[model samples]
Structures are given as structure tokens and as C-alpha cells.
Target: MSPVAVILTALPVEYDAVRPYLTAPEEITLSDGTRLERGPLEGTPWTVALAELGEGALTTAILAKQIINELAPEALLFVGVAGGLKDDLQLGDVVVATKVYAVQGGKLTPEGHQERPESWHGSHRLVQAARSALRELRPDVRGHRKPIACGDVVLTDPDSDFAARLKRSYNDAHAIEMEGSGVAHAAHLSRQLDALVIRGISDFADPGKSAADSSGSQELAAGQAAKVAIAVLRKHQPAPEETPGPIYTGDHIDFSGGTFHGPVIGKQSRP
Candidate 1:
């Protein structure tokens, strides 16, 4: 069997972008009625299982765990579009998360909010593979390896309370999204699987976000993110399966009634 990988998206547009890269996909319905598509990724030694689990951190965490348990993929990737937080990140640019922060984990107090930040780092091997893949991509498809902030709400106003909180706490995050941290946490609990979050900048997390979405930036960003994901798969080499050795029940061989034609070497015992 080919090595398996899971690519999860949070929206239909993101799933549509990735679906085209799968060859001869077959629908798989889980016992819980969750649907997924399984097929070989074009020009790679990977069999990809794809799912779109909708939005929100909690929902993503639940469905991601379900998929991981069902497929047992070598790696899991959450690929989709995100709102750019940095000035350098332009629309359609890709961001491969080196670390994902659950930005909403904090406590409100009289002295103000106290941050209890939680984060998960991306797999080092996967990050290296993405770096290599980015070099071969189109010049217009800019890529960055940076930290991402994940929360429950969709950020539209840069001056919103959540946005201000993000700036004060997760200042290093380059992109804001709704699901990466959930999937990252699920993979972390699995212990044996490597996972990464890749997103494309659809809009700046500002009042202009609606205009950007109206101009189809979301679809373009989704496609760009999916392209980077496929490229990473092409550059990555899965670990080879181990071959089982023959089982030996005893330390010594017993040839009790064998007729030997040649000189047989054995320990002679006195009858």
C-alpha cells in the first residue's frame, strides 16, 4: 500500500482546490457518517485522504481526531485560506505555519487579561520539505514559514477586541485563522503522526476583508495554499515499510528422521 497522508480543509472552496490534484478519488463514509475522499496524489508516492470539516476550533478538533483514527496517515495537513496579519503578506501568498497558537486561551481578571498561551510546533521534517518546495513554485507564489494564530471568531476589524488581544499576546503570528490550532492539537495527542498547517492570505484581517472575499481572493488563496501542499508532498519521502523476518521457535534445529546423502554434522549422543 502507498503511504497515506490526510489533507483537511475548513471550507468547500479549499476542498475544491485540493480535489483536482487527486487522481481517481473514491468516497469513503465512516461509521459515524463522516465522508472523505481517498485517492493517489498525482506524481507522488502518497495516497491522500481528503476531508472538509467546516469551521471553528472545537469542530475541527473533533473531526480531525476522527479522521486520524480512521485513516492512520503518516502525516496530517490542515490547508486553507487565512487573513493576513502582517503587512508583508499579500493576497494569494502562502504561509506554512512553523507554530500554531491557540490565541483564545487566556483568563480575564480585574487587573486585565492574563495570557495562558498554548502552541504546537510543526514537524521539522515537514517544514524543511516545504522550504524546498517553495523554491520551485511560481515567482508570484510567495511563501513564508511563520507562526499562526487560531481562534473561534472570524477577524474582520483590526481594532476589534479579539484583534487587539491577538496583537498584544500573539504578536509573532503572521496569519489569523479558525482551525489550525485544533488540528495541530489533535495530531500532537496522536504522538506518532507529523502534522503541519498551511494557509494562503485571502485578506488582511481588517474592514476590507469583505471586499477581498467579494473579489474572489478566497478562491485564489485556497488554490495557492493547495498548490503548496501538493508540492510539499512531492518533495517529502515517506519512511520505508519494514520487512518482517522469519520466525524461529527454537534455537536448535531437530532433524529426527531425515535421510542424509552428504556428511551430516551433528552432536553425537550416547544411547
Candidate 2:
């Protein structure tokens, strides 16, 4: 009886990528001064919402909670693009976040990026279901592929030492983005909703990665990522009475290092 909640950055390019399989959202404004335009996908009982971007985890959580108050979706999903952190990952790869990690100061010694020990819960079955759906939807693009990686990292100049620190965090971390961490935080704050963040690799964090082929690559990856995320949400039909646990609480929410201004439209990073 309740609706499904999905948060996507309010950009037309990103929206166009996922629009093929999803229905348009009905316009609604929340009490917290956030506006949402939402709709459901065709053939599936999935609902979507387009929320404003540029907020960090705290702001994202606040707005997400407001949306939840109104929509009461059984599951929450955040769909958008990310910057690939590894050389092996080219533009257009999709990443389904299994866990969310935060950065406190800058980069972590030895471990690369220091995760603030704060994490938002994600479902493995949901990520797997999305991956399986990708296999079914785009068999050609993903024939026998390796696992895609997802997580949050601070974005910095490609040539700067900051990026190098992020690179050292994980060998397989494919992408970086602004809102994934906040989105995760928001879903975790819901206290009664299942949440997932599915990101498409749009650009390599390295400056050398060409932008010539990235647009098309990102578009294709965005479609695949949206389709996969939608499938994951649809596959798990929770009982109407099911309620989420304490994972939604903000007890673990942390944003200590503060903010930085990177490339706004071209690259992804926290706000």
C-alpha cells in the first residue's frame, strides 16, 4: 500500500539515462523544504523520486527523512553516476554499493582513504539481484565480467595528492560520488525502510582518461545501472507489515573533515 522511494540527482543527463524503463514521478514538496517529483517503473511496482542535490550526508539524511515521512516507501534506492577511481575501470561501468564509507580529514595512511568507521547498511541479495538483472538486460556489455566496486571517497583534483590517497584505499574501488554517502545515511535514518545505492561509473578519477568516449559510455552504463537497481528493488517483495531495524538511526552518522569544492558538473564528490 505504501510507495517506493528512490533518490536521484536532479540532473537531466542522469535522468535521461534511467528514464527509458522508469515512469515519471508525481510532483510533491516536503515539509523540510525539499521538492520531489516521483513515478513508478513500468511492469514493476517500483516508485522513484528525484531529489535536489549538493547536500552532504547530514543534509541528505534530513531531506530523505522528510521524503520518507510523506512517501513511506518500503525500500529506498539512490541512482546516479560516479567517478571511477581505478585505471582498470573505464567509463560506463556500474557499481552497486555493498557498503558506504566516509572520509574524515583527507587521506588515510597505509589504508589510503580513512573511512570514519561509519557505514550505511546495504543488502547483498539486492546488489546480487541487480547484477543478475544486468546480466539479463545487457548480455553483450557484461558477458563474463568482474565484480564492480562501490563506496564513498572525497573527490579532488585529478593530479593532486588527494586522488592518490583515494586510489590507495582500495585496489578495486571503481567510482567516487557526491551523494552516495548522504543517500546511504538518509536511508539508514529511515529506521523502517530498506535502502540501496546503485552508481554508474561515468569518469575515471585520473586526468588522463579521455572525455571523448565517456559521454556515450556513461549513458549506457547509467541505463544498465538504473535497470539493475530497479530490478533489485522489485525482486524483493517485502511483506506489508515488515519493518526495518536500527540501521536507519543516525547514531553512526559522521562528517568530520568538512567540505571541499572540486569540479562541479564534470566530476563527483561530497558536498
Candidate 3:
């Protein structure tokens, strides 16, 4: 059997679009009050654990920990719509984050704000799968493999101080959203997981947010992002390990655990 993937979203609207893509979907409520829609992808080799965790990285990080601990997914993909930050990225464009920046990290000094940012790059193998998935993207849909900024704030103005600050710090960010960093961090600590953030551009993150949102871009972008996600899954091939797949080895095959330093130090097989 193939491994499972947990797809996370922040809003109901985002969940609505992702839910339909799930096959044999059924709601499962955990003892901790965390709800999940578990199922499989029809043509893909991955089982799906889909959840809508309301909002914020804090909410998302806590829930992510619980879900991964219970489900033990092979990979975790945070899928949803984001406010496009780069000029070339337009509405409905899909961005697969090469790196996720937790943009809110910094310390205010007497002179100026000190840069103390935290960032996580996408899982190497998953990112390779995403790259292959790009070739299969719908012609109408444009996919960008780039960095994205994730924070708790919903940025509405491109000219806002926060926006300008982002440009100065994480200048390579292609889109802005509220969740990915949390999920990434959770996946980080749980060293045995592959993780990535996928977003569709719903708005320009400018003064035109209300206008673009009112025109149904959110739904369109969400759908497109979901499309790219399915594509990524289609391209993904899981390892057939009975235990947590080889992580410490040089192969890095399906590794899902906390930070790996040296090779397997004292771990031994049943002698």
C-alpha cells in the first residue's frame, strides 16, 4: 500500500474546493477535537488526510502535530490560495514554495528591527515531484516554483509597512499566506516527514483585494491550486517500507522524523 498525505487548509471556502478532489472521503473526529476527512486519490498512490484548521500558524502547528502523530503521513502539503506578491504572478497562478519564510520573526531594537527570520525549504524529493508535476499543468494554469512568505497577518495592501518590510527582508517571496510556516515547522520537528506549501494566487495583495475576491478569484485559484496538488501526487511515488522509511541513510528515502544530524548512531535491528 502507498503512504498517506495530509492536505491542510485554513478557510471553509478553501476546504470546500479541496474536499471534492478526495475520493471515498469520510469525516473522522479525533479524541482531541481535531476533525479530518480521510480518503484516497483515485489515480494516485497516496491516501489523503484532509483538514481545515480554521486559521493562523499557531492553530495550524498544534493541529498538524496531532494529525501527523496519529496519521503518520508520508508527506504533508499545505494547500490553499494566497495573495500574490510578485508582479508577474497574477490571479489563478499557482506557486509551489521552494522556501517558506515565517515573515513575522524579528526583534525591535533601539536603532532598528533586527533581522532574525526563520525559514524552511520544501522537502527535496517532494519538490522534485512538484517540478515534474509542472509539465502536466493545465495550459491555462501558470505554475511558479518560488519562495513564499507565511505569517499571521492578512496583508491587504501592497504599500503597507508590512509589505514594504517583506520586500526588504524576504525579497524573493512570490506570494503571501497565513499558514504554511506553521505546518513546515511542525514537519520540521517531526523529522520523518516530507512537506511543501502550494498556493494559488487569489488576489494581488494590493488595494484590489476586495475587488478580486468579489469576482470569484478565490474559488478559481483554490481550484487551480488543488489541481497542481493532485498533479504533484500523481508524480509522487512512495517507498514500501513497513516502518518509517529510510531517513538517516544517505538515500533519504521517505524520511519522516526530527532533525537528522549524523548517520544512524546507535540504532540497531532486532538481533
1-271: candidate 1 lDDT, tens digit per residue:
8999999999999999999999999999987888999999988899999999999989999999998888889989999999999998899999999999998777899998898999999999899999999999969589999999998878988988888888888999999999999999999989878899999999999999999999999999999999999999998888767654444343443488544344334443332
lDDT of 3: 0.88
CA lDDT scores, all candidates in order = 0.91, 0.60, 0.88
User: Tens digits of per-residue lDDT for model 2 on 165-229?
Assistant: 45555444456666666667777666756777777766665553356234475566666666666
As for candidate 1, its clashing pairs are none
The TM-score values for the models, in the order shown, are 0.90, 0.70, 0.87
> By TM-score, who's the top model here?
1
Model 3 pairs whose backbones collide = 190-257, 191-256, 191-257, 191-258, 192-256, 192-257, 193-256
| Positional deviation of residue 29's Cα in model 3 after best superposition, in angstroms | 1.3
Q: Number of the top candidate by lDDT?
A: 1
What is the alpha-carbon RMSD of candidate 3 to the true structure?
A: 8.8
Off by over 4 Å in 3: 243-271
Candidate 3 per-residue lDDT, tens place, 1-271, comes to 5588989999887888888888889889877989999888898788898999988999999999999998888889999999988888889999999999998878999987777899999999889999888877758679999999999988987778898899999899999999999999999999869999999999988888999999999999999888888888888877655443334554333456554454653333332
